[model samples]
Target: MSIYTIIDADTHVTETPDLWTSRAPAHMRDSVPRVITDSRGTHRWVLAGGRNLASAGMTATAGRGTFKNPPKTYEEMHPGAYDAKARLKYMDQMGIWAMVMYPNVGGFGAQQFLKLNDPELMLTCVQIYNDWQTEWASADSRRLIPITSIPFWDVAAAVTEVRRCAAIGHKGILFTGEPQYYGLPLLGDKHWSPLWEAAVELDLPISFHIGSGDMAEGLVKERVATYGKMAAFTELAVDIFLRNGLQLNDLLMSGVLARFPKIKFVSVESGIGWIPFVLEAMDYQFKGNSVAEEHPEFDRLPSEYFARNVYACYWFEQTAPRRLIDKIGVDNILFETDFPHPTSLYGDEVHARIKGGLSDCEESVRRKILWGNAQKLYKVTGPSADDEAKL
Candidate 1:
């Protein structure tokens, strides 16, 4: 009889070594990324930044996982890694009633398959990854909301993929935010329209999660070129805002929101503070006739459309009760624990931290931040009267 109502809006699970290989059709199964020992005597996936895939505690390999390697044991890297029972037990212990789980490896990693430039191959790879992820979430549907990943290279194919994913019971879609992938900028491209339409038609939210897919290449390239550890992560986080702020503004100003009123967009891992600043700057610029003149598609104020459609994750550093509620509105902001990310704060301290920041607000507002807001965003319904009464 658990009474806590916390909903972790974002969390992830590493793909098992057999993820694509096991679920993929015979012809494509062998194409999934394979793990091999590197020059450092560590195991790493051929595709990932080469952080050892086996060292993160997510793998059982003797070498262990690294950012350069996958975990040696899925359980160790992911904590609850592959076991549903362990995951549920941890959720119970931590007072987390539900979570929206994204894939660890197969997510934007599916983009790697796209880079192969074979549509048939990309589609097959995506299907297998989705199948495996769906099975993983079936372990506990009540607690885990699985977000589907789609390959965005071909618009028609992407539309077909979205419908298939929705049919398979996905709550949302995960996409990469990078502009140039293998030497191509996705900005202002018409190829993404159909998939955007499908998401709008299906009334599903599209979540742009951070990682290789959507991360800015400029910073990553700088880090790789310079070999400066401190500068790498710092530049990376800043680059997220610079890149995504434009993308979000583009979606709003391009009449994507107006054309598809049902589509909702969430920018995860990008933090919430940027929302206010971006919206304000856009609105200010719109008044100058520059944004409107350059992009004639926009008719209404850009900020209004954004407020109606966009949502961002709240980080500990960005949690300012009054200013946040005032600038972004309580309903538009949601909280997340970067769970298992080393910096994640997911225990009783969460209650204290949230309480401290939100103490000035009424209990209703606090409860909204704690539970109701996420339900509204995720469209999760509480138990029926009979179900609640049983408790």
Candidate 2:
């Protein structure tokens, strides 16, 4: 293992085709999620009621190397993408001490399941994913940290599931930045306070993955047809970053952070390059509006609250770490390797990128971004006493 105890704040788990079918209730088994080969020879996931969710391309391209053009089949993927034991081995090879795992088929925050006509079946699918995650993390609890997803359609059910998942060992919860996409209330509405409160009470950090909200699928298609696959991928990345910025603006301007001071918000897979600009603009806007008269709940400027509660992660970022680390506060920065994704840093590249990004920084800041921030945010422990003794 490498010298540093790196904790990847964002990673993914490709769900097995039987994930939903095997655990689903007997009455719902016929309609749960399953994989099917299309006439074009591409594997796709079809949810309950026969709705096509996503192709196998994005979910199973981990070990395909530079050949990420058409996306590979599940059989072509490395076992590490789905198997717990194999994943740990991959982590060992990469020197990643731990990772907060998110879902692929679940739409980063399980948002895809909301399309189901039956809310009960949607909730059941979510529970099965959570339970399966718990089992996966059990392979090496200290190394494979699972982040759970809840039923966003019902506020009460979300709260209940949040508590239940935390009790069962989930370190964090993946939440959609735009709940209105599912016809639910916005993040700032009083409707979300109960879920936020439960997250705080359980000490579970709320993670918002890019593209987990109201994603524009048509934009991706247009970009690919006109500009090619690489350009299409770039468009998707840019869209996720822009939307995540809007979500951050909403959280800050909406007084959510002000009301829930103890809770933490993690911007997963969203780079930190734009954080300084956003905070600077927020401060200017807050002052320009004469803060108290407009948003009295905000006791201080938006940047101040962000410095204290919000965290933004970076993987391939080179300039942000050098220029904005001090501005964002070292404690509010985390590191990640998107891992099996098309944009991921594979093998030793993760370490090299992290090292190069933090080259001009101090050891303390490097330590925090590499692993310290995650350890505190997730309450992660170990290289356990036994492991340490052996080391």
Candidate 3:
């Protein structure tokens, strides 16, 4: 039996070398993502047309003990990153009862599929990833919650994928934050209305992971060009964390929440401290700029939509709990480790880190952030009723 009740609200799995090629049809073996060792002996994934899929070694830092250089080959990284059974053991050791898992090869939002010129192949790639991920989570369905990616380029298909994955036990949807960048209609447009309706019907929360938006891609390019790669990553480690703030602002103002009152939106891997700041700005600007006059459909203050439908997660954040949990709202706040990825809360000291960061709050508040809330949000099930009592 487990000794703790911590549920990681967001985490990731490093896609195995043959994740796609093994699952794809014989025809798709060449076009789908596949690992290849180049002449220089460096391992990299390539798409059709031999386009090099650029990756940062930081994507899989588990068991390296330090977030240092890339591991060059799949053998150098930890099995927990790609193996379901291995991750369960790691979760047990870390005292995490459950985790919400996302994918790596597909981009946080599966945006990489957008680059595929063949629209049929692009949608099939999305389906393939989701199907494989579901099988991965089946290793332990109750504790390993799988989030599904959609063929967002086609909202009609996106709606179908959501329902199909939901029927097979996917708890939520991972989507790009800025659809406008993909040449699709924005989330607020009627074009995405069916997708939103499907999400509400399925009772699935929609998560927007950091850097899931094309806006983040644009930001990454501009910053790297200005500061150069090394300095931008080192000097602005917090930059990636902040991109979700823009997503939240757009979401709150988009009227989607108002239109679809039951849908929940999550800002995954984004910290809590900036949320109050963003909400404050949204409410202030809404009034100061007379924004309601421009969009009268917005029936309430922007901040009001947050606790009811918007959620944000935090890890390694000490100040937010001490100063702003109330402003951020306990129900809207979630806890995460972001394990096996860059700056994840892995290793022996992780328990102390979690304790130290959340120490000031009462146990009830802590329990909600750590376990209760996510369980309710993601519909996490059990080790059975009796066993759960001990937790």
Q: What TM-scores do the predictions have?
A: 0.83, 0.94, 0.93
What lDDT would candidate 3 get against the real structure? 0.83
Model 3: how far residue 339 lies from native, Å: 1.5
Give the local distance difference test score of model 1: 0.65
lDDT of 2 by residue, 28-88 (tens): 9987889888887777788755688877666656566443453546776777888899988
Error of 1 at 117 (Å): 4.1
Error of 1 at 239 (Å): 2.7
Q: Which segments of candidate 1 are over 4 A away from where they belong? A: 37-43, 47-72, 107-109, 178-190, 212-227, 290-299, 383-391
Give per-model CA RMSD. Answer: 4.3, 2.0, 2.5
Question: How does model 2 fare in lDDT?
Answer: 0.83
What's the true lDDT of residue 285 in model 2? 86
lDDT per residue as tens, model 1, 335-369: 67656553355557666766677778887776776
Q: Which should have the higher TM-score, number 2 or number 3? A: 2
Residue-wise lDDT of candidate 3 within 1-391, one digit each (tens)? 3475699998998887788888888887889998778775657878977788744244677666344466767677777887899998888677788999988788888888888878888989999989988999999899999998998888888888899999999999999888887787877888889988988998999999987775444427778799787666765556667877887888888899989999999999878889888899888989999988998887889999897899999988888888788999998888888878867887765677667777888989988999889999999874665644644
